[model samples]
Target: MRNLLILGAMAFCLCVHVCSDTQSGPQGDTTLPEEDGVLQLKQEHFKRALRKYKQLLVHFCKLHSDLSFKDAAEALMGSEVKLGVVDVTQEKDLVKELNGTSYPMVRLYISGDIHNPVPCPGVKTVLSDRISYFCTNLHRLSHLCFFVQELTNAYSQVFHAAAVDLPDISFALTQNEEVSRKYRLSQDVVLLLRKKLDCRKHFKTSQILSSPVLNHALLFVNKSSADFEEISSAFSSAAENFRMKILFVLVNVAESRNGRLMEYFRVRDFEAPLIRLVNLTDHVTYHLPSDTLNVEVIQEFCQSYLDGKAKPKMQSEPIPEGWDQKPVKELVGMNLEQVAFNPDKTVFVLFYLPYSKASRTLFPLWEELAEAFRQREDVVIARIDASANDINLSTQGAYPSLCLFPALYTERSHIYIWRKKYLKTEN
Candidate 1:
């Protein structure tokens, strides 16, 4: 885990302990004193908030620390600037509340005793990003709380570290129109970084886009409804970025209605090898603002996306040669020493038991060749009864079939023999 600088902590601690700190570097460190009866924030607490704000702070506050925002905003009745935590454990109720409130409700909506959903989005985010976003938009607490709760859990898995909890930090939300617009922009950026990407694992800008074996690129859009033709043209250069095989997986956070647009743009149903689509919402869109992103959820989301579920296969055939062997080694252990003795010409030997039905048929034919070829100098033949030994082989498919290379054993020069007659077609 990386070390994070709290509101006002030693600068060195934040730098040296950045094991999981995604947002690196030091930004401006500013603070204001408690002049009036309003709550006075400690320097340590303020630094933590500053770091979070600079790195993950989506909105910029025009009113500096000395501007006295709380007193001024309260005086303006039509202001859109808001600062506070919004609890959205009751998701529908919270939305209803926001519908009536003024624009830019800077509430940090926390999950307050609400019904959970499937694949509960794990927490994988670092502490700084979550708190920075949380504190900055405290006025929209309900939106923040609802979204944060889910994102926090999801991010927890990615950072694999604890967030510096700011239980004491307070924010002031107002109805300032300019502040609201700025906050919206900042929120969009935060969502882009937090939701669309697994910042801990994804390739950075340093990685080369064009290569012979594999090529990769990242495409993002403001909304899911962005035109497909525009996107295709925008990324056209990337299509020619590789030589051999190019694989593209588009990741986006869009409205559910845009699902069809994504499917059409990516040609998802055809399952083309060159392009793919992944919806970030499929993982944690339902999360409220206050919900923390944790590492566990990050791991599960990553694992599920990277490792697709295995499906059951229906039986296609009855019995085939080499199907009975549980493992290839079981069939290779038999009569190995005897097969090694033939060095003049290549000896194609099979190791199988006579009792197995597939082996029973293959062993007799092999025996006839062994007898005929024993006196010949050009070829040698042999068989091993795997059943006689303790080796296990799978009987689900083909069995007793000659393998090309069985465990690369030194017992025989080759596992399968081919006659010159087979080579006449190659020339």
Candidate 2:
């Protein structure tokens, strides 16, 4: 009972807090302090606070400006969250360190992301609305860090390694009875403090809107499905090991409240018991091919992802048979990177629509251009069906476009050299 109560508090804690952090940079030695539940933080305080707090919300404001968020900050800060304010006007150095040139900015620094703070928006809204807005951002939940306290250790080195790898999760093993009394746990059993995100209640409209950019893993299930409990248990167990690396969520396809999320993921009701993982940074989504959702299988799927064994869904068509048989090699999505963008070879590509008259007129000219470079093993000429595939470059999206990826080209800073003089079209 005591353990259960404590878990409840931790769950409630998740709904009130958010993130912030700064590295241990050289600063003047001064004892900064916390008063009225808000830390009067300086440049040096962030390093200390980074080690102390799991979730932090920092408000950067001009001291003389309107103190509109004072009450909202107080209401948001609790045992779960530590609130701090920086006087941007006075601490010009701190402002620069935080990469800020403006006042009245709110940034949340979570445990893992110390160098980059997540910008907290909707600060200028009403006090009630501000709290409401903060509550709905699924990322800012009841408690930032989860704690599992018991006498017997229920987990092994896998859990320990995970804790070390992801400092965002707080795990503790204690043989203390007093801890349970607070939460009312009486028996000696394996109890893990955890929070599960059910799409019906956890995912708000804003959260749904931001799903593409979020590191999200979702299990879509049906209430009437016979394997629902087994799958749910396995998914939750898998989620424990991933902590800050992934935001694991579940959705009931049968519930109308979850319909919007289902549509967003393009999940049909007939496709219950499905699992998918999405990368937040790259916006890539991977689907699990198996229908079985067991502990071993789910963990393997997650482990494979962490090991980079899974492939993301990219826009590409199948490579045609003997793609390089012609003078101008025909390229597809699969071979585009290795052939057209080869670092050792200077490459040129013609992106054309086969059906376009203008595209047809360039075929003979393209063949001549390819023949010119055919003898040079250091250079290659290629043509792709642009209308049938995506080149992933903004400027190369249009049909009848020409591009050059020289030997000096880079993945981050790629350029296209389009030659517009060879304009021949069948009128």
Candidate 3:
């Protein structure tokens, strides 16, 4: 079933195509024409569009198998926003220049500045949801508050409130006709207030355990629907109050579907109505007190967890086989930070396509470098298969690209020193 789902998703991605109106250019030149809707961006028009629009959302994807790109473009179609898509396969130079080795990468360019772009959250199927939420909440939170009065006056008041930082809230007036029609707004005008931090109540094993977001995950493990409902209600109330400070997740241990996670968390058969707070960053767990669950107790639990008073029970995962035995450390999404950002050591990472001739050709060079640096305590060498790792290699400019990363302990922040010496060789 899992394999079938994976294949289905792959099929969906394979069907994505460049817009029909997209114009092709010479070998190195890609042209992007001015279009009102989603602009099919090429190398030539990428930077120009960023400079023209105050807020631009660019989707870097291949011509095929890019379902996320299509979904994001469709969701933001009617909004007064500039949306663009880049076919990474067609413009390899541009992709390399931007360090965009990951498929279906989304970036937000604000105020024509290209040096630092905010990465769009969520991946694969959830891309559209995250993009919609971000678009709705960009700059400040937006709410669709209805007010039956002069439209201009309401907008002015909201603008003034946002400008003066009053009410500790930001506001925007969306008078776009298309947006109004899409949302079915019958009134002449409405105030859009920002929403509170959107929290995930029901979590799957994949999302909760793998997400990089650092938060105290309060999991309510219950069997009965009545117990689940009561605890969920209390959790929702507390979650809104704490909003963004913690994550509340509900797990039905009774369901066979969640059996694996239950076992992983070590929830005994008798511990159905139990609650566990997990801190993924530190790999710590805290069990709830034996007393009945309530809003007050849950709040106290969160407060105590935040205050670092709760005793931490360690959670461990068996290291992958041959992890520490490799000379060129294989980089994955989970271990990227632990290796790349080591405070005591400088890391030299090679980003390459595993099967490519160029990558194979450079393997010996990297191995030799790793061997030379093996005894150096302050320096580490690593290599990442660009195809296997979906992480953003922000400084990588080409396949088999070498990037020297400074130690985190250095006063200067992480900087990528790109090496083009090896890339000059023919594949």
Candidate 4:
């Protein structure tokens, strides 16, 4: 969902529409000749653009973000928005300056802290360039610092509201002389404070299993399966419409205590953010089918459920007899959550297609992998038919793949499954 204020597509990669690659400047450099609408930026250019475009939409730090901002670029083309592009790899200092922290999961959280921020390039900001400059640069001349310092306080709230949805990031500005000197600030600079916070620091682990959430016949569980500071602010906005009708709840799947909720919905192996609706009255549950979710998707899911049109999610296939008879334990949708994510067991799963020759060839290797851990109750080597079940693993579209779900679970230990190359015939 795009927040018009920051156009904050939280947790989404930006897709910018680059009309032409034929238009570029200097080979082997992060430079592009100034196109009227698309300004290629440098350190000097970036700072200048910040001042020039009060509502600038920049495409810098082009790893996973800029590509999806095409629509954003197109939408804001001529209106109040200014456009610029920066390749962050070539501008490491710029990223550091903006306080951009690249999480290992690849969910780059640009500080939305108005004092600092994150973005398609670095972080998107609504603060005037003058305020941002004055806040970050303590080395500026005396009078220049004094004039802009007054302007900073006026719009602090406006900027904060825009960034309110950002996951656990905060900002501060300092005018203290000692503070400035301690940090070696420029004679003319003001300091902005920054602090990283854990959003779930005080949340009770047992809240999900509580009676209020489960007993409510119509419930919306908006969960972030990724282990990061998740932003569920969009749901709050979505919740406004259905006030008392559908009780909306938030769940963090990363915590070990919340694993039961994931298993309860059979979404333990699913990787994307999940939106599940439970109707205790009907003794059934429905989950949002789409991989990508937005405010619109959430509303539709809720409306359909209330209207009795939404279909219940697939719980699991019937357990296959002799499922664990062989060395390579077989998994179906029913038993996947129980086995694959066992905190006590180090599980290695080979997701394969039965019809593929490559998958058939991996059987011996699979057996060997299982045989190696046969004596230990802790390690389980298993396989599942990628075609037969509704497992929502992040990796897909290929076969004979391996994923190790380790016993020592942590954000780092989670499987970063490789996407296997698929044969044309299979497609």
User: Candidate 2 — what's its lDDT?
Assistant: 0.66
**Global fold similarity of model 1 (TM-score):** 0.21
lDDT of 3 by residue, 225-316 (tens): 56777776776677876655676777766678777667656776566676788766544568777568788888888888889887654333
Span of 10 residues, lowest total lDDT, candidate 2: 18-27
Per-residue error for 166 in candidate 1, Å, reads 32
Q: How do the candidates rank by lDDT, highest first? A: 2, 3, 4, 1
> Estimated TM-score per prediction?
0.21, 0.39, 0.41, 0.29
Flag regions of model 1 displaced more than 4 Å: 1-190, 194-343, 351-356, 384-397, 403-427
Regions of candidate 4 where Cα sits further than 4 Å from its true position? 1-300, 303-312, 410-427
Global CA lDDT computed for model 4: 0.55
Weakest 10 consecutive residues of candidate 3 by summed lDDT: 132-141
Task: Arrange candidates, best TM-score first.
Answer: 3, 2, 4, 1
For 1-427, candidate 4 gives per-residue lDDT tens digits of 2465456543232432232333343232444446444566666556555655555545554545335434434545554545556667777776566544442211222322223323432223432232342233334333222212332564554443333333233333445565555556664443344322222223343433333434222222334434223336556556666655666766655556767767666665345366778754444567778755567777888888879888766555678899998888989877887888788888888878889887888789789878888898998888888666766554434556677777867122344333345322211
RMSD of 3: 19.7
How high is the CA lDDT of each candidate model?
A: 0.33, 0.66, 0.62, 0.55
Count of clashes, each model: 120, 19, 7, 25
Model 3, position 395, has a per-residue lDDT of 40
| Comparison by lDDT, 2 against 3, better one | 2
